[model samples]
Every structure is written in C-alpha cells, then in structure tokens.
Target: MSRNGQRGQAAVPPAEFRSYYGRAVLKTPVWEWKIPAYLFTGGLSAGSAMLAAGADLTGRPDLRRTGRLAALGSLVVSTVLLIADLGRPERFHHMLRVAKPSSPMSVGTWILVAYGPGAGVGGLAELVPSGLRRALPGRLLGRMARPAGLAAAAVAPGVASYTAVLLSQTAVPAWHEAHPCLPFVFTGSAAASGGGLGMALTPVAQAGPARRLAVVGALLETAASRMLGRRTGASAEAYSTGRAGRLKSWAEALTAGGAAGTVLARRSRTAAVASGLALLAGSALQRFAVFEAGVASTKDPKYVVVPQRERVDAGIPVRGDDRAPAGGTG
Candidate 1:
C-alpha cells in the first residue's frame, strides 16, 4: 500500500547473511553423542578388515589373528555406538528391511552387517584350538574364510569412502563441496590406520605389505588434501588455515614422516616404531580435521556463498550449493 510498494522497490538487499560464529544456525544434532562415536568405530573396523585380508593373502597367520581380532572388536564397538545414536534403537532392524541405493547410510549399514559377521566368525576360528576347530568346521571353512576376508577387504575401501558421502549428503558446506576429494582422503586415512596397526603387531618379514600400504596411503592423502584446498575456494579454507588448519598441517607432516620411516622399517625396530606412531598420529589428526572443517563450514556464510557464486558466474548450475536444501547437497 505504500509508495515503495507501488514503485516496486526492493524489499531487502540483494545479498543478505549473518555470521554463524559461536552459534548454530541449523539443527544442532540432537540425535545423540554416539553418532560420531560410530563414525570412529566404523573407520577402525574398516581399517582392521583390510589388515586381516592382507595378512591372509600374505601367509602371516599371526598377523591374520591380530587383524581379525581388531576387526571383530571394532565391529562390536561400532554396533554399540550406532545403536546408542538412534532414538529408537528398536527400529535398527528396519535398516536391513529396506534397500536404497541413493542412501549412503543404507549402503553403509549393509556393508557393516556383512563385514561384522564375517570378521567375527574368522576371529573366533583363530581363537579355537586347531583340533577343536577341525571337528566342527567343514572342509571348505578355510576357503570360505579366505573369500570372505577378501570381500571384507573390497568393502573396506567403501567403508571409508561412504562416511564421507554420509557427511557430504548433509548441509555442511565444506563437506559437500569437497565430496570428490573427501572419499580419497578418508580411504587414505583408513589405509594408514590399518598399516599402523600391522606395523605395531607384525614381525619384520610379515610387515612388508603394511609398509607399502602406509606409503601409498600417505602419498594419496597428501595429494587429495592439496587438491581439495586448491579446488574448493574458501569453503575448504578450514582444511589449510586456525585450529583445524593446524591439525590438517600436522596430519600432512605426520603422513610424510610415516611414509619415509616405513621405507626403513626393515632396517631397525626403532624405525618401525617411529613409522607406526607417525601414521597413527596422522590418522587421528585427519579425523579431527574432518570434523572441525565440517563444523567451521556450517558456521560461515561466506563459504556458502562464494563458491556457489563463482559457479553461477561460470555458467555452472550451482545446484550443488550446500545451502540450497537436500536437492543441492550433492
């Protein structure tokens, strides 16, 4: 009814935003504390599963036992954490009741179910005495176990990558924008974690694959992170720049140090220890950086706007903008 309305003047500025520092703009995750706990447990399970597969293939029974135990323990912990995260833990069965390819969480649930049981059985087999095991086991038990371990190994890579997809599917700017690189980063971190565990437990002769895995994982992590930093604009600034920045930098340093030390793992016990410690430290730091970056991205509007605007200017759809709701959280 006013003159401004009649003249069709704008009601607000073309660009509007507010800072999110020290405040949450969206739902502050009321689900439960155990969600992140499950994430960590899942990562550990995936890492151990890989180690078990590698040991089986390499003819290291001792390493195989260690790896299988680690995998089983991680699965138990992960199950507990996941159930604790749900408000209706009773509905956990509903997870297996449905199949949805579009859902990363669903895919992860299936992977967990398959890997958990396989690892547990394999671990239990290792625990029983050979005579006792032979009494109940079929002639094909070893064959079945071998293939199951390999299946777990194949899924282990996805187990790491799927978590990234899970987070990126949400409204987190830093996470969604870095989806491509995040999977690779997480895969590398998982490999490093497994390698560290192997180095810590296996004898020098049996530690060959573990060392190579660590070196490859380190190189991959470093490259993926650098690419993420360069590609995502300010959305990924958290990865390289404050507390999160420092953590990411430290992760990189540790990864490099670990890779270098792995080369000398055969030389001496001290070198192996150093390498294992460095890789483990790097894994922890990388996880922390991932969470920190997600939180930081959610707290800043500039990160949401800048990248999308660039995309828009470049004639890209910008539909993947994290602020655009579920349709764009790709």
Candidate 2:
C-alpha cells in the first residue's frame, strides 16, 4: 500500500539497474603480490621434499642432501613471504588459533606450520653422514632422522596439491572459474621451480632426475596453458589479449625449451642448467601475469557484469544479485 492510500508499483526490476566501472560485482581479492610468492615457494618446497624422499628410498645419499636443503630452504622462503603479506606479522599466530575448514587461509596456515618444521628437520638430518651417525652410542641420529624425512616425504605431495585447492576455492574471477587448470598449472610450476633449484645447486653428475622432472613439468604447463587460453569470454580474455598473453607466450617458449634441453642433460649439463633457469623465470612471469589479469578483470565493471548478465537473462543466475526491478515490469 502507498502512503497516499494507493498501491505502490512493484519494486523496480533488478535487471534495469547498472553499475559504473569497478563497482565490484564479485567479492574483493584478499590476496596480494605475495600470494604468488607463497605459491612459488610452497610448490618448490613440496617438490623438493618429494625428491628427497625418493632419494632416501633409492639409497642415494648424495641426492638426499639436495632434496632436504631444497625443501627446507623453500619452506623458509615461503613462510617469510606469507608473513610479509600479513597486515600484522606478529598476529600470524592468530591463524593457528583455530581450524576453519571453510577458510583457505586457515587450512594453508596449518599446512605451512606443520610442513616447515617437518622439512627443516629432514634437511638438518643431511648435515650428518649416515655412517658417522651410525657410529654414535645410540645410533640415535640415524634412527630419528630417517623416520622424520619419511614423514615429511609422505606429506609433501599433498602440500603441492593443496595450494591448487586453495586458489580455486576463492572467488577470484580467473582462479575460481578455472579450477581444473589451477591444480595442473600449479603442480607443473612447482616441479619446474624445484628442478631449477636442483640444477642450480646439485652437481651435474647427478641431476638426471631433476632434468626428467623438469621436462615433465614443462610439458604439463604447456598443455594446461592451451586449455586456459581456450576458455571463453572473460577468463579467456585474461590469457589471450594483454600482458597475460605475452607472459603465457613466454612461458610456452621457456617450457618447451627447458623440456627439450632435458634430453641433453646427461651429455650437456650447461644446456640443462640454462633451460631450467629459463623455465623458472617463465613460471615467475606467468604467476605475475595471472595476478595482474585477475585484478584487471575484476576492476572493470563490464568484465564482471556482461557475461554474468547473459547468464541471468538465460535463467542461470551466475553472478551477484541484479539490482534491476523485478517481474519484467521495469
């Protein structure tokens, strides 16, 4: 009823309403540049941990040091990047104050705290040669070190995959909509980054597995990128038309070159090292480009509203509540 004793028109149809640019149809991005650093470091740590475990199981002590140190170093770097991103680094401990399955940050915080110590212990174990540790009174170091490395190893791959879930679960335009590619892209990035670190540190005489892993990771990244480029509308735009496109192209070149270089690893270590470095550099650029494209997409109201409006008109209701009047009366 109207205040004047007449019935009021039904509320204006929501579809009739429109917003200017950057009004934020989607939620704000809680992440920042440090998020990519976190991604990069986490990937490296997990991949290195896996290699360490493999070396241990295969009875290769020389390879063990490479893996352990890589894992521990990456963990340290990742933790630092994460804290740097926080508004209050001292309050980072507040994240561990609870367990929130629905919150990616909470889950990731717990994973990092656990993985950091686990990998650190594994790496420190490398300082003691097995034979020397065995000569001790209780054979104590050997007994404790081996088991700790094994446990960290068991958790490493999960650490690699969880970041994928973390990003995909977010409302970021490019990330959430591209869940399938997120995991594969992240996994490949991790492997490539780890391979780079290994090649940089490990002796040429024993970098065969690192080379192989690099090749595999590069191939996966290239393939996933193609799919990402094919995504329709807004998501596709991120991968094909701007700085992201340039970065993706560079990533492709680096990935291909690195993977191909692996074939010469046994005979040409220099080539292998160069290729690994290229892959790592490419991965960093790719992460930066994705971050930029996501922000661009969300900042433009057209990108946010157009496709979503199409969906709503088609009865799909894909985006936020339309502010237009209802029942086609507007």
Candidate 3:
C-alpha cells in the first residue's frame, strides 16, 4: 500500500492548482447596507441600555436619563433597519413564531422584542408628571421601569454579541474561522459607541464613566481586532486587501485616536465632542469592514478550496467534496 493508502500506487502529490470556471464556491451575502447599519445601531442601543441600568442603580439620574434616551432612540432606529433588510418587512412577524435556540435570528428577534418595550418604558418613566405617576397604570409603569431596564441590561450583552455569532455561523471563511473573537470585537465596538453617545450628550461632570468606558472599549476593540487578524492567517487576506482593508485601517486609526483624545480632552468639552464623533464613526466603519470582508471571502474560490484541501492532505475527512485532484508523476 502507498502512503496515501491507495492500493498499488505511489503517494500522489497534491494538485499544483485548480479552478472551477473561476467561479465562487459559495454565494455572497445578499444583505444590503441596512444590515451593517442595523449592526451598529443595535450594538449601540444594547450598550446604552447596560449603561443606563448601571447609572440608575447607582443613583446617577442624569447619566441614567441620557443613557435611557439614547438606548430608546437607537433601538427604534435599529429595529427599522432590521425590518427593512427582510425580504418582506411585513413577514418579520414570522420570526417570532417559535423560540428556536438553534436559530440566532429567532433568538435575536425575541431579545429585541423584550428589550424594546423595556427601554421604551424606562425612557418614558421620568417624563410622566408626578401626579400622573401616582395614578393606576402610571404607578405600575413607574415601578416597572427599573426592573425592566435591569432586565434589558442583562440581555444587552447577548444582543451585542449575537450578531457576531450570526455572521460567524455562516460558511464564509473569514467569518466562521473568527467565531471565537468576533463577539469580543463587536462587544468592544458597542461599548465605545455607547460611551461616545454618553459623552456627546451629557455634561462634563457626568461624563466620567463615559470617558472610562471609551478608553476600555477602544483598547478591547483594538486588541481583539489585532488578535483576529493574526489568527486568521491566509483566510484574513480578504480583510487586509481591497476595500475592506481600507475601511478596517481607518477604523483602527480612528478608534485609537479617539481613545487618546477622550483621555487627554477630559476637561475640554469641545475636544471631547470631536473625539466622541470619531469613536462613533470608527465603530460603524468596523461593522462595514467585517461585512465587506465576508462578502469578499466568498468571491474568491481559493479561500474555500485551500483549507479543505489541507485537511484532506492531513488525513482528516472533510464532510463535503473538498478534495483536490492528485498530481500524477509530475
């Protein structure tokens, strides 16, 4: 028997090269700009909800109010973007038909359902008059606000992270391979965006936590992105080349610069505003870069073919037809 276990044949060398009519092995993502926009808005909303819950619990009513309002507004816009991405916006209701733990989309839909009303109630709580708040339903809503906001906060991390999983679950080489790190990267982005909003909208005195959060988030995002790029190896070439690379490069620069600005400009409201805007822009650009990278990965057949061929060469059985042809006597 030969080394490859083929009867009466010498071990065949791997094929030098191959191509399938220069076509893509997988379909590119059909999602539009709405998807990336939804990712940014949803993450920002979730992160803001978490911050609101923290501020409320700590008796920082001003920060709490700012966080709540930000959460509510971002959540509304996020939901609209999500629905717009659907094939038929009206059919979005179908996503709630079952609680499928195996389906990220279903789980995410339910999370949004729970979070939307919770954030809305929390945002509106302080708006009601004292006299009206003492009334029947008003009193009930007032009482529910804290608990609802807390509950939403508890689920907020999942909201921010699930989108990462949603992308990672796909067959896209760049996405599936980076599943372990994508959630962390996205969570960091969410935090930075939420912090940016807080800093931009709140007074300097109340912006302490926002500044701290911005610094921590920026650090986390930068570290995770660098780690992901290093770990993905050749699969990440799509991310490093072409349009995705340009977007990601700008994102990294802006995130780092904004974080530095936030720390240095703590006392300067004008400088802080500029930094906050940069962070927000950076967060959005990161999402767009990831989206574009996944699409690009699918376009190139080598990304799909090479990894599987490597597995086959190593004596591991791949589930699909990924084996490369043997090179004869060359």
Candidate 4:
C-alpha cells in the first residue's frame, strides 16, 4: 500500500520505476592521501623546473640552482607518492607500457617519464663543480643542462594540469562538472606552491620573481576556484557542506592571506617565511578538498540521479550505462 494516502494500493505504480534501492550510481574511488600528495609535489616540481629554465636563461645562477634542486627533490617525492598509491610499487612500471592519447593517466605517465630524466640531468649539472667540468663527461653534462632544463620546462605545464583532467574524466558529478576550470585552479596552485618554495629558500633580493609569481598564482587559483564552484551547480554543494567545505575554506583563506602577506612582507624575512608556508599549506589543502568533494558527490544518489532525470525530461539521450530502468524515476 502507498504510505501517503492510498489504503490498499500496490507499491508499484502502473508505470515501472526501478532503482537499486538508492545505491550509488558510480563506484567510489579508492584513492587515498597519496594521490593528492602526488598532485602537490608534482605541481611543485613542474613549476620549479619551469622556473629553473627561465632562471638559467636570465643568468640568475642562484635562483637557477635553487629551482633545480627544488624540482629534483619534489619530483622524486612525487614519484614515490604515485608508486605508493598504486598499492603495489611494481604496478607503477606497468603504466609505462602503453601510451593512450585519450587517457589522461597514460599520457601523464609518459610526460613524467620524459620530464623526470630531463629535470634530473639538469639538476645534476648544477650540482657538479665547474672545475669538474674540465673532464670530458662533466663538460658534456654541463652542455646538456640548459637544453634538458628547457625540455623539462616545456612539459612542466602538462604535469601541473594533467591531474585535473584525470579527475574530470571520472563520472563523479563534482569532478566532471568542474572540468573547464580544474586545470586552471591546479596550475595556479602549482605556480603559487613553486613561488612559495622559492621565496622561502632564496634571499629576499633575488625573490622578486617568486613573489610576483605567487601573487599571480594566488589570484588565478582563487578566481578559477570560484568559477568552478559556480559551474558545478548542485555538485558545488558537495564542496561547500562538510569536511570538503572546511578544507576549501581554509585553502582560500590561507591563499588570500599568504598573497597579502607576501606583498606586505617585502622586507621582512620572518613574515615572508610565514606567508610562504601558508601558501604551500593552502595548495595542499585545495587538492585534498577537491578529492573529498568528488568522494562526497559519489556517495549521494541524488547527485547521480537528478542530472540523469533532467536529461530524460529534456528529451536528451542518456548514456547507455546511465540510463534509468524502464519508466523508472532514476
């Protein structure tokens, strides 16, 4: 009997409406902390590599060395995180076996394979003494440094942006809906993180470019995140309502405060350090927030059903996998 008013009506209506007892529409991702950690470290590495190439071209040896070391260290850490996330470290090697143009993960694996060696060679060149360059091998390595750095720099943007695309490729409502702006948000956060590292590690006199980059990155990240929220519609609620909301709020606050502090602390080393730490923390939190939001979106049946329902009502063809059961509501 229908609970609302009918005394003896059957539960099933004349029109068939079937669902899996409100089960989730998609499988929940099993990715854990390592993935977001990889995103942060990878972005930092890529941004630093790009900075290193620019510094080398501009004759800023100090900045170039800092950038190189940063890139190398972060890239190594990022690779470790990625391998850890694969559950079995050996699985990481399997990723190198194929190149799928349509698969962001496959493409990103190749990009990392290419970027890692270039960045490593460039970093090693910086560490080798000039006197050592008198040796044939050393001289060859030195000569290869600039070109390697340039090559790594060329692929750096892809490293920073591809993770966002990977997330967007998923069926999770929050992630897929924010595709247009996720790359921009992540790229900007990467720039901010790289700049923050530079400001923290380099002397104030040589940190001007880093400061500028941080400011620009902060602005872009903030703006793109806002745009993403707007574009996500109902999915945005997943980001705004729970643990995800708290993390994102913290990310925004820290990013804004850090940018302001960077500007105001032009001469104060202590303030600069504080601001730089804030920016780095903020960037990491943003990645975690995005991950959590996607998870949240997947848990709620409405997030899956509502959109599919709207499409049906509008006479739009739903994907075969997403189609509701015959005459079903969802």
Candidate 5:
C-alpha cells in the first residue's frame, strides 16, 4: 500500500466537488443591468444633493444650480431604473408600506422616499419661471429651498451607502466578504461621480469644492477598493479575474487619470472637463465591476466551498454546527 494505504475510491479525491452537478450553490442575484445602473444613479443623486447644499451655503450660484438640477435628474433616473428592475412601478410604492430598519432593502426604500421631495423642491427652486419670480408660490419655493436641500444632503450619506449594505447582506460571497469596505467604496464613488459632474458643468472660479470633493472621493475609492481586492479569501479572487478584473482595472486607470487631471484643472478648463468625465466614468465602471464580481463569485464553486473549508480547517463550525471549536483541525 502507498504510505497510509489510501487507495481505490478514497485515493481519487472524493470525485471532485460537484455539490449539485456543477450548479451554483447559491442562486445568483436576479438583478439585471438596470440594478447596477441604478446603483450609479443613486450615488450620483446623493452626492449631487450634498454638493448642491454645500454650494448653496458657500455662495456659488452656478454650482448650486448645477448640483440641484443634477441631483433631481439623477434621482428621477434612479427611481426609473429601480422601478424597471422591479418589473413594475407599483412594486416600488408597495415597498413603502412597511418600515424595516434591520433590512437594508427596506431601509433603502425609505431613504429614497425621504430623499425625493427635498431634492425635488430644491431643484424646482432653481427652475422658477422668470414671470413667476415675484409670485407667492415661487417666493415660498425660494424660502423652502435651502432647508429642503440641506435635508436631502443630510440624508445623502444613507442614500449612498445603503446599496452597499443591500449587496453585502446577500448570499453573494464576494460582496459579503467585501462588506467592511463596501460602504466606503460606494460613498466615495458617489462623491467622485457628483464631483465629476460639478467639474464638468461649473466653471473653474466656482469649482473649488468640486475639485476637492473629486480628490477626496478618489482617495477614498482607491483606498477602499484596494482593501477590498486585497482581502484574504478565495472569494476576493473573483475581483481580480475574468471580466470583473478587466472592468476593475479600467476603473482604477480611469479614476487615477481623473485624479491626476484634477491637479491641473485650475489651469485649464479642458482638463477640468476631461478629469470630470473620467471620474464619472470610473465611478460607473466601479459599480458595475463590483456587481459583476459578486455575480461571478456566485458562479464559481471555490467562492463557496473554499471559504467553508478554511473555516473547517480552523476548527470553526459552519452554519449547522452547534458550537464552533477554536483550535485548528488536521
């Protein structure tokens, strides 16, 4: 016998890990492309709301106008994308029937509900017709605009980060593994997208906040994404392989290019627009890359089995275990 006499069927390595005839262990997310697009728009809206509030307070009328309008437009787009994904518009309103703080999806629904009005009023404040300037309704809108914008800004963080929670809570191993830094990744992407838009639309003289926001967003996104990619697990490999890897690589490159352009934006309007566009593109790609990674992880068996094996080797009990041991096992 060879060594320990391990032979025959036992020597064959257990007929490979076909848990269910090569089928995915977990059901992949049913979300379509619109879901990822919604992720981008939601972040864009949240970030733009905050930027508008900042611009309003800082006496930058052009920036404020641009931000307000952008927030409103993106919010509308996000709603449409989300509704489309649900396959019915009324399904969205149905989600409003109850509040569940413990549920990320539920919380996100509420956040969007709370976010819309403030953003709408804030943007509408900017679009008052010339003839209506002296009207009481216009005057009321003007008076309510600042408070409404600020409210939206206050809620924007939740708007930007909740999507991360929604993704992480799912069975997708890549996203679950990346939970710790996902919020930062998302919020940073949101900021980058919004700031990029600002840089594109606003002139250099009033674009200081946008420039700073872009830089900050880039920093947070790059750092957090690195953290995500560097995570110690088989699942993280999904982030650096196949189409997901390609998307992430492009995202990183574009984001870096955008960050670099921000440095020279003050000197050239062309640079500002170019940088802004790059950052916006990078943010969208980043979201799509993350979504793809999660979906990819669900397809790859290693993302499921390998992690469990690691836990078992470490004497950690899996889901059904009554008590997970603390010591390593042979």
Candidate 6:
C-alpha cells in the first residue's frame, strides 16, 4: 500500500537521473569514432581471410585473389584506426609485452600479431610479377602463400569475435548485458561483409559460395539482433532509443535487403554488386549502433540504478565485483 493509501501503482521511470556532481556513474568510454570503425574493419579482415582460404582450397582462383587482397587491405585499415584511436602507436607495441588470457584486449593483441604476418604474406604473394615467380626468392614466397593464408584463416574467428568480448567485459551496461549474443552478431556481420566484397569483386559465375555466405550471415545477424532487443535489462533501452535506434533500424533493413537480393541474384552481376554494397553498409552501421548504445548507457544513470532497484524489489541479489582490474604487475 502507498503512503496515500493507494495500491498496485505501476513504477514510472524518472524523467531525469543524475549522479554525483551530474557526472556519469561510470566514465563514458574514451573511445570515439575510430574504435567502432576499427571494430568493423577488424571483422572484415577476419572474414576475408577465412573466405580466401576456403576459395583457394576450392580452386576458385578469382575469389581467392579477391578475398586475400581484401583481407590485407581491411587489416591495414584496422591497424591504422586502432593506432589513431590510441594516439600513440607505441601503446600497441607496449601491450604486446605480456599475454594474459583473462584480458580480452591482451588476447586480441596476440591474435592480431599472429594473424597479421600471414595475411601480409598471402596478399603480397599475389602481387609478384609473373616473370619473378621463376626466380628463387619469388618461388619461395609463392610456396609460402597457401600455408600463410590458411594459418591466418585459422586465427580469424578470434579476430572477428574479440572486439565483442572486449566491449562486453567493460563497465558499460548495454554491452555487458548483451554479451551472450554480441559475438554471434559480430561474426555474422563479418561474414556478411566479406561475402559482399567477394560478390562485388568476383565474377557472378564464381560467386556461388559468396551468395550462400551472405544469406547465412544475414540470418545469423538478424537472429542475434532480435535476441539483443528481447534480452531483459534496463540497459536494453539504450539500443532501442535515440541515435542507436535509428542506426539499428537501418542496419536491419539493409542486411535483409542485401540477403534477399543475393538469393535472387542468380547470374546477374548487377544484382550481386548492388546487394554486396548494401551488406557492407549494413555491417558498418551495426558496429556504430552498438558503440553508440554502450556510450548512451553510461551517460544515463537510470541504466544502472533502475536495474538494482528492480532486483531488490524482486528479492534478487544485485551482482557486483569490488576488485579493480590488475595492472601489468602480472
């Protein structure tokens, strides 16, 4: 019963919520546009490397060539964006000094280190002049191509999914709440983007696998996206409101349209290219949407407070970890 003798009142969320000195309860992440862009490019690079290996093994030379070059290009962009965001290239190098399995960031650094050389060699091997392949050095490089590309492909899953893990393990409520599906969403987006590139770059006749990949990726992405929207948490509001909501709406439309186009494309090069472009746009938007949502959750104190209050009302234990993350002391 209410103090005024009313009963069964519905809880209404406050119009405004603020923390000490009007500052966010959690520090808004220092990350900016570059971080989200890096996430997309990293996923693209991983997907392309995996596609390249599959294409090469299947004897689809054109698809293999496109996938290899795309992977390398995406990797290069991913590295540059990461470096730019850090404001110091040496920070990345410094992080390489120690390997910690418990830290997603640390594991990601090692994964990149292992995957980079192989992707580099695989892509560069294609650039050798036809006449040079007869030379000893060129022949040696050529011989190294298959193994290098396959090795990179083997490591690509970690590259595609680590960003999701990194974001979720942070203090951000929106990211942490949706951890179960983030990896699936990211990997699916990566595959979709790679398949898009393959379709646009390769001839339609050789693009069968790309088409299949595009459809599968689209389905996985869509399903995981639904799970995110349906998950129980106040933080889920972050994804469905404001700028994030607009971007997510667009992402879903483009992904679905692209998949539909791919399925009906058949031998039409024009349709393949158009659909590929759409998928790429959708994948980029998806990253931005997730990034914006996490940032939004931190900015609004309700995301944290309401959840704890609800848990208390329901007689559920509120979870917490008082331990601060350990430094390089390890």
CA lDDT, candidate 5, residue 75:
94
The digit string of per-residue lDDT tens for model 5 on 164-272 reads 8888776678988888999999999999999999999999999999999988998899899889878737877988999889999998899989988998998789999
Which ranges of candidate 6 are over 4 A from the true structure? 1-23, 314-330
What tens digits encode model 2's per-residue C-alpha lDDT throughout 118-215?
A: 78778776776656776763365556667777788777766776876776565556655567786788778777777766665667777767776777
Mind sharing the TM-score for model 5?
0.92
- Model 4 Cα shift for residue 297 (angstroms): 0.9
lDDT tens digits, residue span 1-330, model 1: 576676665888776444455354443224333554566566766877888888898788877877777777877887887676665677678889998888776887787777666777666666667666556474345557777777777777777678778877777677777888988888888788778777777787778877887787778878988888877667768677676799899988998899888878976767887898898788778877777777677656677667667777799885533333422221
lDDT for 140 in candidate 2 is 59
Model 6 residue 25 CA deviation (Å) reads: 1.4
Q: 150-232, model 3: which lDDT tens digit per residue?
A: 98898888888888887777788888777888999999999998888887777777777887888888898889887778877
lDDT of each: 0.73, 0.70, 0.82, 0.83, 0.88, 0.87
Question: Which residue pairs clash within candidate 2?
Answer: 12-325, 13-324, 13-325, 13-326, 14-323, 14-324, 14-325, 15-324, 16-324
Better of 4 and 5 by TM-score: 5
Which one wins on lDDT?
5
Give a tens-digit lDDT track for model 6, residues 192-252: 9999889888999888888888888888988898788888388878998999999999999
Off by over 4 Å in 4: 1-19, 129-133, 321-330
Clash pairs for candidate 6: none
Error of 1 at 216 (Å): 1.0
Error of 1 at 193 (Å): 0.7
lDDT-better candidate, 1 vs 5: 5
Worst 10 residues of 1 by lDDT: 321-330
RMSD of each candidate relative to the true structure: 5.6, 8.2, 6.6, 5.9, 5.7, 4.0
The TM-score-based order of candidates, best leading, equals 5, 6, 3, 4, 1, 2
